[model samples]
Target chain A: MRGRRAFFGFLGKEVRHILRDWQTLLVLIGMPVAQVVLFGYAVRSDIRGINLAIVAPQPDAATASLASRFMDATDTYRVVASVADAASLEPQFRDGRVRQALMLPSGLAGALGRGEPVTIAVVTDGADPNTGSLMEASTLAIVRAWDAGRTGRRAGPRIDVETRMRFNPTLESVNLFVPGLIAYVLTIVSALMTAITIVREKEIGTMEMLLASPLRPYQIVLGKVAPYVALGFLDVVLVLVAARLIFGVPVRGSNALMLAESLLYILTALGMGIVISTSTSTQRVAMMAALAGTMLPTLLLSGFIFPVSAMPWPLQAASNVVPARWFVVITRGVMLKGAGLADLWRETLILAGFTAALFVVGIRRLAVRLA
Target chain B: MKAATREPAGVGSGAAHPATNVGAAVQARGLTKRFGSVLALDHVSFEVAPGELFGFIGPDGAGKTTLFRLLTSLYLPDEGESRVIGHDPATDMWALRRRLGYMPGRFSLYPDLTVIENLQFYASVFDTTVAAQMDTIEPIWRQLAPFAGRRAAALSGGMKQKLALCCALVHSPSILFLDEPTTGVDAVSRREFWDLLARLREGGMTMLVSTPYMDEASRCDRVALMQQGRILRIDRPSAVRAAFPRPLLAVTAAGEGAAVRIGLLAALREHPDAASVWPFGSTLHFTDRRAGPDPARLATELGEWLAARGIAATVRPISATIEDAFMWDMTSAEPAA
Candidate 1:
């Protein structure tokens, strides 16, 4: 008998085994989708509803209007404290009553009447840098708007420049996590399934039967991995659909390109699984190796939760070996940046090279073990 | 003459090969294997002719399963050469795999798949469907047909062995290697399983079976008595029994009680010339240090010796079996000497 028919027969049997076992089937689809939704909701980097403290040493009509303007304008800030002295700002901040404090010096209306510029101090908590920066920006916008209305004339040498955000104009964190989630989901599902499938055969004593057959080692590996490629892609589609429906994360680029890139990443992950399974004998060991060797590195180093650039130089260098890192970049580029293949050829090429390397090494190890 | 006249088929010897010799289904020369610090198989050598049902009979830890694994191409030997079905298992693994059927010692079939599904999968993996080879496995499958839908793990031990045999035979392999196929089976099933092997042998299927049950040695065409990673002797069962060099005696306690039997066994071991004594069922088998120890005189003296101890008993000269030979060989360093 030729190899192709036997290969397909083996693949069909594997698919049957997977489908017959309910626990394995559930884990295959459940873990990835849950992660996508969980990371999207719980790990967002957006801030809202900041508390404001206004310290007016001298109470006047200008300070009163300033306080009303902040409340009536946007939901970004609420006036939670009104103190008579600037010294009271310390306890307001220390007691968690306010995230930002505005200090208006004495005779603020008199200074404006004399045509002198008054310095209004704005101090914000710097514990959470993102929220702090956002508060500072909103505060300056409110102060400048009030001053512009009071003078009714242009400030010195003011230049009007328009800044526009492309792709994700709303800056929703889900848009970022959804693409990274695709890489993550495909990485874990493909690698884990591929790793455990071969080791399961080894554990059951079927591997000896397989090796004794005419099927080559490479044929056995390819057959075992072929079903998971399809399953992983199905998972990719499921995650993408869930993200779009639940979180409104848009896929602005070519959907075909995103799927194609995800498929490439899945192949890389499956290759990693083969490498893991060949080096280990039992399913327990293979699963541990897959989780520790592939999944954790993918989660930490792929810039999924933490940005890669903020990592130290040595860790940044080590992140290059992680396939998920490259895939994350490619997915984000295609989905969020609406980038084309031409723009992402470098990342795509790096992923292709890494996949080929892993596959070659894995197949070589499998062949050696079979021999 | 047996080796010279055996190759009428010329199946595995189309070419003049160094590793393969003509006529034999399997041939090994000085095969040695090791597992870390333990020497599993040490300098073992043997041959199985075409259509010969060869048995490796020994206690546990004898190199039977290790030799089986090596010959089946599931493992490589550290220090020797072997040819299975006309090719070196080390180099021609795939070529040899096409012609071999291997059932490992453990219950290694897929626990998740049903009995029938397991059979089908094994067949399909060898590029042959179960239906195509139905005639070959019909006997085993018929017994397993009633529990076809049950998972392999849920089957009884006897049924699991039958299912494993069916899967191994479903590919219609030319040579079969069964490692301890009857180890955990019931006595009736074990007998029936050997009957199946005999039938397969009659159909001209070469088989190598291993077992720890010494009684099953008489069922094989030839047997290799193995102990401690070495072959003590390899010959026909009758030859092995005849080669036991000492005079044997059987002593039975007249009173049918466990206490009397135990006292008899202990009393016989105290005899001056008794080299070894082991209880077989209700009777005790004893061997003398000398080859021709005057059977009647020894029996009377042993009877008198037990009578003096107030343990009534009867003693008689008896023929030795493979188990007796094995026991004698295990107790004494030299059997043939």
Candidate 2:
């Protein structure tokens, strides 16, 4: 163990660096808040209006009028353009003018009048998997409603599945994503940013000057870890404040719990940073590794954006290793549901384990790598 | 000569002051180091007393930096052992670290921090504050104090070097390791910086500096001539110059036919008495093969040969320099010149 006086002394200097360079701290906190606000107001799961296209080739008065009812009724769908045949469908899809296309085959109205089986082909673009899935589901619901009205049926389909989006009853994308984005950006800036910084110093020879001093390796490590932690904590508060003021989002969880979770999350983040710093010999390598390692999973596999439950088993397993995944869970449990420690015990333990393991690995890496 | 003998009490010790004594600032034995396949130091052995200005003189890859690293405890020697101020670099590194200062070739001080801040930070790292060292670093600090608040990155190369020096000195260590400290500095700054080192010697601080500059090597109490990871020679600067085995001659010509005259003088190497001839300036620097070249005949013969080439010149003997010894040592094919 390092002497407390030296460790705390070095830690104090690091804190001084953090306080002086407050801009980095601001960015750390502000990023999550802004992301949350942007997602909350501008995105939603239950969309009001989606651009829809139709091709009713019969061109009869009743057919065209009924199609008009589907578009104008309750504002569920907005008619973008009408095509003549299957040939026009491809052109419309390629041009990106239509998300989902409706095709009522010839004599579709006569079949429907005779109560014969009538089915409308709903062709949807599969490029944007999220919106494409939404478009497909929403179009099916609207067409079913029209069929139900014609049959004079009051009862709906069996097995009424109710999805209650936790933390965000409205299923706002920002509400689900803002906290995770905060973790991502802060991790990038703190871990990856500072990792390259150490290599840069070593390259220029300043590390030699520092290493030659009486300060122990642990003292040096403490000094580096201290400043970034304060910055990370401050960033959490900044984003939270901005998120509430700008996006009308409230912290449902206790602020203290949120802070404690953030501290653990940053510990994991900074540990990875030290490992990276010790391994790399140059700033370029550090930057490349930092950017690629921090950005990818935070966006794709963290359950911050795409639901982890819906992801492939392998990807879900991979997400289990990513620190951001645990952080998002902790954030939602603490911030949205206002849950205490019990609600996040498992995730909290995982995060603590990651922090401890990374720290051990980082220290071992320093010992093996430096001299 | 008498004034030269009255050396400062804590400065350069007596002749044969190369022992790695108990109180010695630095000690190394058979210190061999290799970077990958490249042998940086081979069986290197040397010592610096408590207050000696020792220098490592050689070409770029002559293992100067490797030796410096071993001394500063930045590198662990592959073969030999080193004790800095009685602390084994391989084991008691943390303890050794407190008593030694190091300045690398490039400026490593934090660019974002001011000069004063950098000095203060380094000072506090050793459990001492900057205020206490203000008296010790007053001279160097006075030069940099005016712009102490500015970021170190924006300072001129010379100023940056000075600030780096100040930070290294702020802790007031027992020994200092400077690896090519003045390689990129200006001549004026180099002189001023060495002056500071001399003053530190006055206060009893051992310094081991490495440089490729032969001119600067002359100012050291003793220097080690290294090449290919081995020490070729180690002695006082004056002795190294004196030990050159050949008598030297200096020549000059300020006329338009100087090149023609220099060309003919080079042709003297074919003569029985002429050992080697090299161009130093407008004229040729020549050395006698044996001893006592007939000056009258040599001058007359060279004058006639120059006249044949429509050239005019003058020649006379001059003192040998450290560069001459280095050049002679590098190319064994060339007879002693």
Candidate that would win on TM-score: 1
- Model 2 DockQ (Cα-based): 0.36
**What TM-score would candidate 1 get against the native?**
0.87
Using Cα atoms, each model's DockQ against the true complex is 0.45, 0.36
lDDT by residue for model 2 (B1-337), tens: 1122111112333355845366777777788998899888888767677788888888998888888878777888899887888898888888788788888776788776777777777777777777888887888899999998887878987888888888888878878888888888899999988888888878877889888988888888887777777766667788878766666666555365755565566555655666667766565666666555555555666556556655455666566777666655544422221
* Superposed Cα RMSD, model 1: 5.8
List model 1 lDDT by residue over A246-356, tens digit each: 887778789999999999999999999999998899999999999999989988999876678768999999999999998998888888888899999999999999899
Candidate 1: Cα lDDT at B55: 89
DockQ of 1: 0.45
The list of candidate 1 runs beyond 4 A from truth reads A42-45, A53-76, A82-87, A100-171, A367-371, B1-21, B254-262, B334-337
> A229-338 in candidate 2: lDDT tens per residue?
77778778877877778766667889999989988888888888888888887899987888777667777788877888878899999999989998998898787788
Q: What C-alpha lDDT, on a 0 to 100 scale, does residue B208 get in candidate 1?
A: 93
Alpha carbon lDDT at A101, candidate 2: 79
